[model samples]
Target: MTESPVLMSVDDRGIATATLNRPALGNAYNGEMLDALIEGIPRLAADPAIRGLVIRGAGKHFQAGADIHWLSAAAAAPPEQAFASSLQTTRAMQLLNEFPKPSFAVIHGACFGGGTGIACCVDVALATTQASFGITEVRVGVAPTPISTHMVHAMGLRHARRYAITGERFGPEEAMRIGLVHEVHAPEAVEARLEEIVAAMLLSSPAAIAVTKTSLLESNGLALSAHQVTQLTNESWMVRAGKEGKEGLAAFREKRKPAWA
Candidate 1:
């Protein structure tokens, strides 16, 4: 069998760890990884024995968001396929956002684009002091449509608009200040802090926690209509297939400033 793009394990204590496994590319999200997350998150949500979840990344980075190569391929796909491809990251974020159990994330290094969405979706987002974050789609002339709602939810519309439009990368301190991350730790203290959170959560009433999460999400979360989904999908594809999008991708691949700049 082929190696899975995302790796998952359930510990003896019923804590499930879903790891973004493509370290060689900064744990970038590609089609396979998105599929893995879309399939894995809901499956984990449905498992009765699972207590909680910890989303993390392998190697140096947590996630650099959508793979640039995947973005290029998606840009070239048929309109129908491109729309579906654009929505996969959104779906995966939704699944984890509405997960019935407690969700946590351990972020380090680059948490860019869709990666920031994953952090926003979790109940508790922790990052090392050295971690960096950005919405960043504008840098490639692509809209941050899929991650927009979550970004707003995490950081508020004002900050979201500022970062989303500027494509500026900020440090973990800014991430925490903007409420995208709950805690920041020194590199060596991250694991201990994670365990502390996990243990505290394990002591809570699991049923009560589930109900609370469901209630909160239903009351104050992103609820998109069919038309809205289509609009966002179209927005993503439009930028990905547009002249600027092509120029941006080519510039990224060539390691140069885009033509517009």
Candidate 2:
């Protein structure tokens, strides 16, 4: 049997860690990875023992985003299959965003495309000084449909619109300036800061924290009902399976500008 594509472990303190294990591919996400994340996050969230969650990559890069090879193949897949893949990723992000406990992303190296989406969904996103980020879907002639909501939530609509359109990479300082990251630290300091934040979270009442999160989302007009989230995720998948998405994936693989450009 193939080894699992994602890994989850929890400490005695109810601190859960979710690692993206596809290091060889710079942690690029595929269908299997998405399914794993979608399934794992809720399980962790529902666990009374899990007080906090931390998301990270297995290797140097945080996440390079969607697997281009998978995306290329997905472009030619049946519409249903292709759309299902997109929905899986969208669902994973939603799960993290709506998780009751405090969620954090410990980012280093490249955090691009869907990676940015994941980081955006977390309540606290801390990046090493060397970390870089971008919403690069437009470069390949596709849209960041699924991640757009989280991106706007993290960086505001104005910044999201500019960066999503430009697909330009930015460093940790820029990310903080643009409101994408909560803090920037040395690589060695990431774990320390994460611990500090997690400790702070633990001091608050768990139930109260969850309720506060709900109130905050509602205040920001981001509290999506279950049905609304499902519907929006489905729409994201539809776009990813369409002509523009196919062309975008093809363009990236071919190392050429998309025809739409």
User: Evaluated with lDDT, which candidate comes out highest?
Assistant: 1
lDDT of each: 0.89, 0.86
lDDT of 2 at 172: 94
* Tens digit of per-residue lDDT, candidate 1, span 1-261: 767889999999999999999999999999899899888888888888999999999999999988999999988888888888988876777778789899999999999998998998899999999899988888988898887887888899999999999999999999999999999999999999999999999999989999998888777746555676677778888789888988898799899999888
Report the Cα lDDT for candidate 2.
Answer: 0.86
Q: Provide the clashing-pair count of each candidate structure.
A: 0, 0
* TM-score, model 2 to reference: 0.94
Top candidate by TM-score: 1
- After superposition, the stretches of candidate 2 with alpha carbons farther than 4 Å from their true spots are 226-231
Candidate 2 per-residue lDDT, tens place, 1-261, comes to 766778888899999888899999999999899989888888887888889989899888999988998877766778677777777777888888889899999999999999999888999999999998989987775678778888888899999999999999889999999889999999988899889989888999999999999888988888666676667667766666777877887878888878888
